[model samples]
Target: MQDRTLIFVLLLGLLVCGAVSLTVGSPLPAADLLLAAMGEGDPRHRLILLEIRLPRVLLAVLVGWALGLGGAALQALLRNPLAEPGLIGVSASAGLGAVIALYFGLAGVWALAPAASSLTGAGLATALLLTLTRRGDTLSVILSGIALSSLAVALTSLAMALAPNPYALSEMVLWLMGSLKDRSLHDAATAAPLIACGSLLILTAPRGLRALTLGEDTATTLGIRLPALYLRVVGGTAAMIGGAVTVAGSIGFVGLLVPHLLRPLTGHDPARLLLPSALGGALLVCAADLAVRLLPTPQELMVGVITALIGAPFFLLLLLRRHLREALP
Candidate 1:
């Protein structure tokens, strides 16, 4: 898998999946769909394409891109094979904030309240993570993140336990499950800037991360400032994760799944893995969302649920393979 070929395939998949996404629930013909997409067909069909499907597709891509890039950055930064977006507390904290918004009826006052609250939580977690691990090594950073994640989960459970009503509890639980459904272009726009900025920060990581493969001491001798590198990677990851959670709730596995799948293609180069992972994430989410829409269930299946179903098994298999390999040697 040459990088060029891999990129081309990913891009083509994204385009095909995106087009398929817009037509998943449509009864219209392909020709009519094209007309509607171009603003020259039935108004109702056009509305569905523009207002309903378009936004959903955009959000799926954006969230996937953020998750994949952030995940790769975190894995490279920590030099850990198991690293994912949730390892940093962003998922739990963002989830807790969204739960708070819905649990207390804050969402009633403003439609975007949940998104705002989620971002705030992510920011706070990032701040706290940096503060706790400021002068510490990667181990300290990982431990601090785990601590924050634990606290956030505990608080979220408490909130659910004391919910004013079962309905409130249900709502909180659903949002935390993560989905790209019912999103709007506004949501995509809201998430784009943070994701873009964070991606920019992480894209600069290849040289440093490559050097880091030689150990931190060797990296330092090679002129890599470990502290600055850590800050850039962690801060960028937080921002991207925050942006993703703002719209998609707590979708997981894109970050965890994409990079590892592409590692062989990149020959284990952490830097080379980022772009492919991001593209692969987008393709997975788009295809998954399309699959969810096509399912025969009475209600549309949630994208988050589908990914979890896929990712959990893959994760277990990955662990088994890793342990087996170690045992073999």
Candidate 2:
């Protein structure tokens, strides 16, 4: 499909999925839900649609967009198709930060504390990675990312293990598993600025990324400042991934999957992949959340679980295909 056509289709899917999300779990008809959202229907239905559902839908879209865009930017920067926000440890560290806030009871008192903490954690991880890999070789960066992610994961596990009570442990586990249930407009509002800013930052790097495709020396020859490009990508990834983890916990693979899925449609141009990936991510998350709501289980499945179920198999298939191609010779 043409890039423009694919993007339009993804946007249409996002809108349709978002609409379905708002009305999916409610017993009221779609028309009634729409009326309630506009404040002209039953009060209970109105509360369900507006107070409960709309914010969740919005959060899903925002978080998914950030992850997808951040992933694409990172992949472009690293020139690694497998690179993602989580692979660099930012998401794990951000989750740890939020967990610390929750464990210390800070999140209960300050509406923004969790997100702030998450951002700090993500920033620190990026800083450490940049410091250790001063030469910025692709292999060095990836290795450092792996080490940082491992450390973050270990710390998070330790925190869970030492939780003061079962309730705390359960809360941490559920949060890590990821869900959009019970999120409010306040959560969405708090995350919006960070996500928006991060997206703008990432969007600014496409020219540099496109240039770098020819190599750092070539990009420098083209007047792209490598230092500034690195900073922009790191800062943008931190903000986007941190905000996303804060809002929805460590929901995985939207970043890894969305860009990969849409890259071909964008003619394999990293610059062209950003917007379509964002829209596709939003559409996927919204649809997944709706599916979780509609499932027959006594408790709704976590959105993360659904994404994992989908992404894990796809990842294995990707590996298998690569191995087969490599073995073909």
Candidate 3:
């Protein structure tokens, strides 16, 4: 009952923030003007409400939700709070795929070029990660992820360095920074189904995830099929994180922070954290998007930049606490 109340309040807060984001921007539309625009909106006003603002807001919410859920699941499965989709080369590999497609002129092959390449790359990286760490130690898995991420980033840099077209280089740089600017309905549509399906898969695996709370040997003793469960978790994570990066270009740290913020409410139970973490993540990102628009700045910061700024300090705090704990007798 308490959990439901907390989730309801968080979700309601997110909805309110989202509505406020729609109403406020440069020149800051009046409340009456905003309502009038919504009622009998002119093309210009409607375009601002729908195309310019709404897509940015929605994409932020969706990406944050996906990352938060995926991160919580990964941490639960690995029993490591540091486990995150981006930490494991997922986002880097997806960025590499997108950069390659753009560099090769394949990004213009169709409307789906970027999405297809990103999904493919994420899938490959995930497969490599699983293979390298199959029944291996946690430290080994983390090392493998770091190696893969380094390789992907290096390749992405090489591609950008060698690109013959300045336009392609410009696009690649913008993408690596991660932004939700000027996204269209097509981008949203392509990613939505994948995120939905991935989220469903993660949510459905609660039983298996809970089983994993026991040691692997004990889980096996209890008749859980480790291989199948791992496949489902990895595949679902790839789909959502890959599709998200495809559209939004590597937004960072929502995965890392959202779960931490909501875990207190979940009593540290991975099962209970999933839905609440997703909601909290959506709210955080939507609130950040609102801040980006409301801030008095000449240039708009990417949503990713805002998250990293907020998250970096939190990450450092966690590291400090952990260090202190380890140092204590």
Candidate 4:
């Protein structure tokens, strides 16, 4: 498909999925829910529509966009289809930060404390990643990221193990599982600025990423400032992924899944993949969240669980395809 056409379809999908998400959890008909969202329905319905579901929809869109855009940027930077936000430990570190905040009761004291700590953790992880990896070495970068991610996950587990009470441990575990349920507009507002800033930074690098595809030497000769590109991509990804982990608590695979699915439609142009991937991510998350609500299971699945179920198999397919290609030649 043409890039513009693909993007348009993704946008339409996002709109439809977002509408479905808003209407699914309520007893009211879709039309009535729409009216309630617009403040024209019963007071109780209005509260459910405006206060409860709207924020969740909005958060899903924002988180999806951030993850998708971040993933595209990271993949372009690493020049690897498998590259994702968590590959560099940003998400894991952010999760650790939030876990610490919850375990220490800082989250109880201030709603935004966990988010603040998450951002701090992401920044630290990025710094450590850069410090540990040699400049312009993709293998080193990935390895360092894996190391940092492992360390962060270990620390998070330690925090949970030492939780002061069962309630605290349960909260930590549930948050780590990831869900959009019960999120408020305040949570959306808290995450928006960081996600926006990170997106801008990521979007700025498309030309550079395209140029880098020809090789670093060629890109450097074309006057692309590699250092500046690295900084923008890393900083932007950190901000976006950190904000997402803060609000959604480690929702997995949206970043990885969206880009891989959309890249072919974008003609494999890393720069062109950004917007469509963002839209696709929003659509996927909205659809998945809606499914969780609409399904007849005894309990609604966490959004992350839904994504993991989809992504793990997709990941295996990619691996198998790579192996087949290698065997063919």
Most lDDT-accurate candidate = 1
Task: Write down the lDDT of every candidate, Cα atoms only.
Answer: 0.88, 0.84, 0.81, 0.85
Candidate 2 lDDT score at position 239 = 77
Alpha carbon RMSD to native, model 1: 1.6
lDDT of 4 at 259: 94
Q: How does candidate 4 fare on TM-score?
A: 0.92
User: What is the RMSD of candidate 3?
Assistant: 3.1
- Write the candidate numbers in order of decreasing lDDT: 1, 4, 2, 3
Q: Residue 230 deviation, candidate 1, in Å?
A: 0.8
Candidate 4's residue-wise lDDT over 231-324, tens digit each?
A: 7787788888888888898888888988998887888999999888888888888887887888799988999898888878987898799899
Candidate 2, 1-329: lDDT as tens digits: 78889988998899989977776774788788778868997899888887899999999999889888988988998998989888778888888887777677676698677667877887788778767666645676678878988998899898888887787778788988888988989889877888898899888778998987898889889999887787777778777877888888888888999899888788899999988888888888888888899899998899999988988899789879989999998
lDDT of 2 at 277: 86
Q: How high a TM-score does candidate 1 get?
A: 0.96
Judged by TM-score relative to the true structure, which candidate is superior, 2 or 3? 2
Q: Order the candidate numbers by TM-score, best to worst.
A: 1, 4, 2, 3
Q: What's model 4's lDDT at 215?
A: 79
Clashing pairs in 4: none
CA lDDT for candidate 4:
0.85
- What TM-score goes with each of the models? 0.96, 0.91, 0.87, 0.92
Q: RMSD to the native, candidate 2?
A: 2.3
